[model samples]
Target: MTKYYFLLFLFLLAGESFAQNNLDSLVQIRGFAIAAPRPDGLPDFIKFVNEELAPRKVNTLILRVDYNYRFESHPELRDSVTLSKKDVRKLVDACKKQGIAIIPQINLLGHQSWAEKTENLLKVYPDFDETPWVKMPAKGEYKWPNPDGLYCKSYCPLHPGVHKVVFELVDEIMEAFEAKAFHAGMDEVFYLGEDKCPRCAGRDKAVLFANEVQKIRDHLAMKNQELWIWGDRLIDGRTTGIGLWAASYNHTYPAIDLIPRDVIICDWQYTRDNQTAVYFAMKGLRVVTCSWNRPEIALQQVDSHVRSRDLSNKELKGRFYGLAHTVWSGPTPFLKGYYANTQDPKDGDKTPWNTFKVMFEKIGKLETGH
Candidate 1:
């Protein structure tokens, strides 16, 4: 009888695992990220969760483990100031207790800078430097404000040694957090064929994108894990000259069919209500509608995402997934103050994070028109 009970226990555990996987089946999962640093130099993400998420039923969080600054994992010297292991563990534990899926983001190819004065990555990989279309002759440099004392010049994708270093970054995060899915950022692939780099000079942009994506996919596959990437360049077909450098601003990509359809595409529009969400759905890809965090920028993004979802239902027989809002740069003082003041609002633009929770719940209501 004891042996029979042990067999039953194993069977029950397997069923439980299966059921948990099914929980993500119907689509439309909500998520947030600690991308922007708050005024106190610490992201108030945990506070946001305690004060906002628990009440609203948000269950997924994406923490960007690597931002403008370099972590210890960098092959070159490490940044002394980095988030501690203890804090990361605390974050994971807190989210787990709330039943949230934590997906940490590590930029693989671009957005490497944290500060202009310091050399976090650009100094290490000088060959990857891009000649900006709008050059500053006086400064003899063309880089954006890397407010956090980090570097920005992206590592050259064609550089053989860079892969090993990037892989180390990804490995460190996966090992530390034990997250199931890794977000390998392949966004904003500018500097593709800067005159200085011979390896990329004449290569077709689409092929270049596919090549980099495949490298990431292969690396993740070896680790028995899956990868998610932003989906703009791929949508711009090869014929359209829609590489990351310019495609994003125009919201034009070739076609989705040519790229690996299995990958989840985050179709985002921040300025206006759009049908791109519906277009992505019709392409048979998993779509997550993204809204921006800027109070001025977020409402239109939120309305766009919500409207897109509704349109998808009517236009294509596509599966509706969920909502996500991206907060770019360190938490701007204006936005941060707005959120702090309005977090417990009786009215006004609830922070984009707040908007996401509300929009996500509305996805369920859409079916019944509640």
Candidate 2:
């Protein structure tokens, strides 16, 4: 009887140790929520914080606020319906109390388009267009998945005066949110080295690409902030199916090798095994997997992040961080309880990020006991 009791104690200790190891592996579970600064949107966005985001053990929010911020530096760049600096401060204080990091996303290197539906950057400065003569399409002129849609304009990275305006805009957004890191939206930059642009023409595409990323990284470094960008642009499209999505247009690989080692890569893969996350991890850059609006995909991404950590390779160890699931489509649902997404295909119409949020919460609670 004494021997039996001794063996049981050993078994219980081993089990607890295993649980700790599993929990320690994941650093954070984040939501990529975009905040619309309108009056109607602010209430829901705040509710998303107090109700959904706080309870779930979701410690980070990579908010893509866009031009919704009221900018003192660039008044023309802000939308007519924008969040006042005070409004953002309230959310920041609220989020701080809940122990969540509010990282603001600003469109930096690419994403300048305005036909019918408008984006503010290039809508205000047309000469900033990378391909000014590509014949900008009227809003809704191109159907979804149209490669012509790939022609969405980008500002010339080589333009002499572009970064002056870009830096001021970034400074305003970062200061307003009191952000620790900045997400420079440098994905799907399709128009590099175009003949229509005088500055970018005949430039080596790879040098041009790495230079743009380094410029942003260096700018953020001055203020002692970290730089983050989507991993799609760094992925090798020919090998990875990620090429099929927004684009593999420039196919910038080996280029990831050129940027600062401290820069975080937000590797978003909606479908496929997200081998890109592993590849980035292997390269010694800190990486996190991002999921789009699907439950099964989010589960697989979390699993992939875990399985990647389980590998024996020393270079692949430790630098791989956490997972962030995106909530792009809206009205953003304000959920009551924190629950992880399951394998059921017909699960009620929650966005992929919501499902992923619950999934992370479930895993995170086991570790932090939150």
Candidate 3:
């Protein structure tokens, strides 16, 4: 009996080791990101998920669900056209059947306003605006490099009432999607720690940024969900020469060291292969290279990500998570362009639909070991 038990133990140990090795060999994540479909468009979106995404082995879908859902917790914040619980369930069911992880995103802190219009949160609660002094321009009067230096508006991180409302929405949305991860869109945060704000006037921008990131991360951690954010705010624009849009010109880059290591960074670059993924990995954070509207650059990003994993040691290789193709347009328009196989005359080959097809095809080939 003793001899038989010893043999069984050895067999189990060998089986466990083999399973671990197999998992480690496979790509960690194959992801696609886009805006969530409107309620009327859910059927087509689900069909795309079942037919296109599943065949290509996309295991992760990040839907930008910012203010697009019917919120019970905060009814005032709901968009005119929104996803009901039933609509969210359809998406959830589709992704679950395909073995894809669905992560819902809300643009937090920054992206409170666009060109000349304010988004829901700040519109409903005017006191949350980080730069309330700089008024938004009229509909057609908005331009870059204006005297106000306005790009997108950010909510004051130090506002006491901010998180109370934000957290409620976060919880409601996460529950609706049944998501295990939440993407807080914290990219291109230009206004932080501005001198005019009553509460946040002279605070360190890096500390403020890190504090907000850590707060969100900690809140999610309680439920054991992960927090993902864009990597641009954590990168130094001046030193890297990647400039303000792709990286950060504000002093918040130091937040890279201050923020928790577990936060996943979506490092995005459009026109060129920035190689900033390596920097993130070196900083002891897992990073996914994100691309938009540039097929060539997207392809290069895939090659670079694969190579990074192949060449690095075990300690560093895992930090090079994978690549995510980002679509900036609405789901309906993107689907129309994708099915029609048409490119924007103005954008030509520099369209997100083109990049999406090319990048994912490469990813599919890689997954098959072809």
TM-score of each: 0.71, 0.84, 0.93
Highest TM-score: give the candidate number. Answer: 3
Candidate 1 on 1-370: residue-level lDDT in tens? 9999999999989876655454334334666655633224544666666666655556667666663334567636345555556666666777777877777787666565433332355556664544322222234353454332223445667876777877887877777677777887666654454455656666655666666777787787787776777765555524443433424432224434445655666655555445455667777776766665444444454455556555555534334466666656444543465365555354365466455545555543433345
Which regions in candidate 1 have their CA more than 4 angstroms from the true location?
A: 1-27, 36-44, 67-72, 75-77, 113-119, 130-152, 235-258, 293-319, 331-335, 342-369
Q: Worst lDDT window (10 residues) for model 3? A: 18-27
How far does residue 161 in candidate 1 sit from its true spot (Å)? 0.7
RMSD of 1: 7.8
Counting only residues 3 or more apart in sequence or on different chains, how many pairs clash (N, Cα, C under 3 Å) in candidate 3?
0
lDDT of each candidate versus the true structure: 0.57, 0.72, 0.91
lDDT of 1 at 153: 43
Candidate whose lDDT is highest? 3
320, model 3: CA deviation in Å?
0.6
Candidate 2 lDDT by residue in tens digits, 231-311 = 777877766655634336474565787888888888877755656777787788888777766667777776777767776
lDDT of 3 by residue, 88-156 (tens): 988999899999999999999999999999999999999999999999999999999999989999999
